[model samples]
Target: MLPSTSILFLCFLCCLSPIVPTSLNLTLPHQHPDPEAVVEKLQWKLNVSLSRRQMLGNDGKGTSSGSPSSFSCLTGNPIDDCWRCDPNWASNRQRLADCGIGFGHAAMGGKGGQIYIVTDSSDPDPANPKPGTLRFAVIQEQPLWIIFSGDMMIKLRYELIVNSYKTIDGRGANVHVTGGGCITLQYVSNVIIHNIHVHHCYPAGNTNIRSSPTHLGWRTKSDGDGISIFGARNIWIDHCSLSYCTDGLIDAIMGSTAITISNSHFSHHNEVMLLGHSDGYVLDEGMQVTIAFNRFGEKLVQRMPRCRRGYIHVVNNDFTYWEMYAIGGSANPTINSQGNRYIAPADVYAKEVTKRVDTDEKDWTNWNWRTEGDILVNGAFFVPSGEGLGVLYAKASSVEPKSAGLIQQLTLNAGVFGDPRDSVSVGFSGGTTTSGSSTSNNGGGDYFGMIFGGSAAPPPPSLTITTALLSLLVIIILNSRHPLLYYIHPLLKHST
Candidate 1:
């Protein structure tokens, strides 16, 4: 019998040795990364930090506790409140005060000793005084009109001209000004148009080209623009949605500055936002403008605001399915575009491999498309423009064939010629020109010269001929050393 210790040691050695396969092996398919995890990681890096207390609000002092009488009173000298001692104001004040202890005095001071009338749907007397119809009375110190209602709709027959300091408190209402040619604002300053929906006001038959431009032009007759701010300053257009218009959604034409357009949605129009028109008063340069956190939707084409030499800060906006270029700036306007998600058309990635070759017969010397760090993938070269050309599409094989041809054509078109007189003949083939040419070829001898002229020597023919051959080689290499090659052969034999 073998030694007992030796026998145990031999058994241990056998267990530790690698197992030799008696049959074929198998492998699994490639697994893609999780998209949700990618989105979550991106959000984690970009989410703005906010205090928990700020979101919930101060203990109890911030919100109304029920009694209108207990409502916090407003206090500002030369206040613009429309709620005061008017008979209409008293009735509206009492109705709200009866609700509870917190519903009385307006948080923003009420206007003193002026009657501002608001037509109520449930009032017995249409013209006479009614509770809540008075809403808030404005002190007539500075020519003001105030209207208040919750979800109220009002129709106007004539144009409403607001000349002085006017505040129309809709109390969050859908204010419809219909059959009126237009609402004109003349020499108005410090106008606050907040939380109101103004719509469906079309231009009249009068071709008053001075008052309205839509009547004169043949293509300008649709629902008309939502709001027109002419000769106004310190304007705020917030939390508003403008749509279904014939012209632009928001027209801030001529001499309107110090504008802040935040938290708004613009869609369904020819021109979404028009800053200054050619005919209007020339807006001065360096006007401060901020466009933040707005969603611009689909089917909108040519959405550019023409501002002359203004400072524009466009940040944190989502643009989807845009038909043409999203934003264009003229007059050397200072524009900063950051953190915007641009989704390309869907059909650009349907094919596995496509080859495109640019045979520039007309200008063989000008192969503009060939640039440094450009990669040719599966017989297709993907060249990007600007600094970010390769960062996003860095992979060697994923660029489309058509993109390569487009970049090459651009390169060739920008080349220089040997003869100064003949601009088309870029870069000399070691020849002297009639104009006493310098030996350095300073103008045409650089990279720019190569872009315009054909290569000094013809590139190896194998460079073009081997593209398809290389692709086949890659396929054969992958198949020969495949993880499950052993199993695949056996499986095929078994099936046969």
Candidate 2:
């Protein structure tokens, strides 16, 4: 039999192993070293940014109509407000690599990649586009920071399949991806899409398409979501405008995790966003998404979003209007809604924002869904059901919920950065005018190159709770029978 110390050590590990979420598998990729650690880092960054803005003695208020030099560094828009208004923004391009918030805080996309300019707007050939086209930039084998040279609208003839390690920055141009196919990120990782307009995406597929510089595949009929993520991880989608999609504005599925969708606008669409694939798709249970600081505006229907069995953080966004409902779900997904302003439409029957689709109270009531500090306007109401407040709060993965009053300021600058070259008019759906702007080098990066770009390697594999526990069990059993197990002998010697 094993000695007392060996048995105790094994017991300790086994007891601790069950802390792993039920959705994880043995080969989970891009798992954080410690998610709590990432969250802590994000909190610290946010605090420092806010504190610095306070020290400057100027809030992100007034107007974006003035010259770029006079723009407010802190726009009161939580995402853009954090770093958009600094006059030195053009010189600090890589600061955006550090500006990621929520679950995708670690997704440093194309941080060390070479800058690739998309100078051509024509996509005369979908299968083989010109070297300077947007399609060409995304399919490159190496990491690339893609930027546009000027204002151009890309009417893609096919879905733009993107490869790994890319950042499509549309800050300096009036770039719009509309009137045709949209973006597809599948089986790739570490992608950042910022400051572009993706709207009116129509479906186009059932043809051969180049996914990368090396491989071309026959794609099925595509659902023209503004963005579609499948089997991908470490993604950050920020500061874009999405609307009028054939399908979901954005959708993540097939075990995709570690994502943050922040500081963007979505309007005039049905089925806005979808977090997981389906109820029976067990791999999605491992999905974790952060939906923060976005705007759901102007004639949107339901599923903003309809989730499956994943953990989602919906925080500090502006829901301007929802016709049927705002947030819906099935399969007992855990939704933590905090500090958002949900302005329901005048339709009395649709005032309720949360929908437990195909689920009765007896089932979904046991699901962990909580609403904290949310402002429900125009008779908007949220029906929450789940564990007690203490239990739910303890299990929540997000930062402390901020006040609902801050929603306007947090989401003030939703959508892509406005071009200083054009005049913009500010308006609001509810009762407040949000701060708006159209500039590229907002606060984080310089116009052309950011400092954080490097040939950064993907993060090392992390230990899951289940894996740790199983290893401990094997160690214990071996130690009990063969105390001199060769592999563990060193550990045993150290212990002794």
lDDT of 1 by residue, 346-381 (tens): 334411111112222342222211222122121121
TM-score of candidate 1 against the unseen true structure: 0.41
The sequence of per-residue lDDT tens digits that candidate 2 reaches over residues 189-242 is 999999999988987877778887777767666777889898689999998988
TM-scores for candidates 1 onward, in order: 0.41, 0.74
Clashes of each: 26, 19
The lDDT per prediction is 0.33, 0.68
For model 2 the TM-score comes to 0.74
Candidate 1: C-alpha lDDT: 0.33
Tell me how far the alpha carbon of residue 25 in candidate 2 is from the true structure, in angstroms, after superposition: 7.2
CA deviation > 4 Å runs, candidate 2? 1-27, 31-47, 58-71, 76-78, 388-405, 419-496
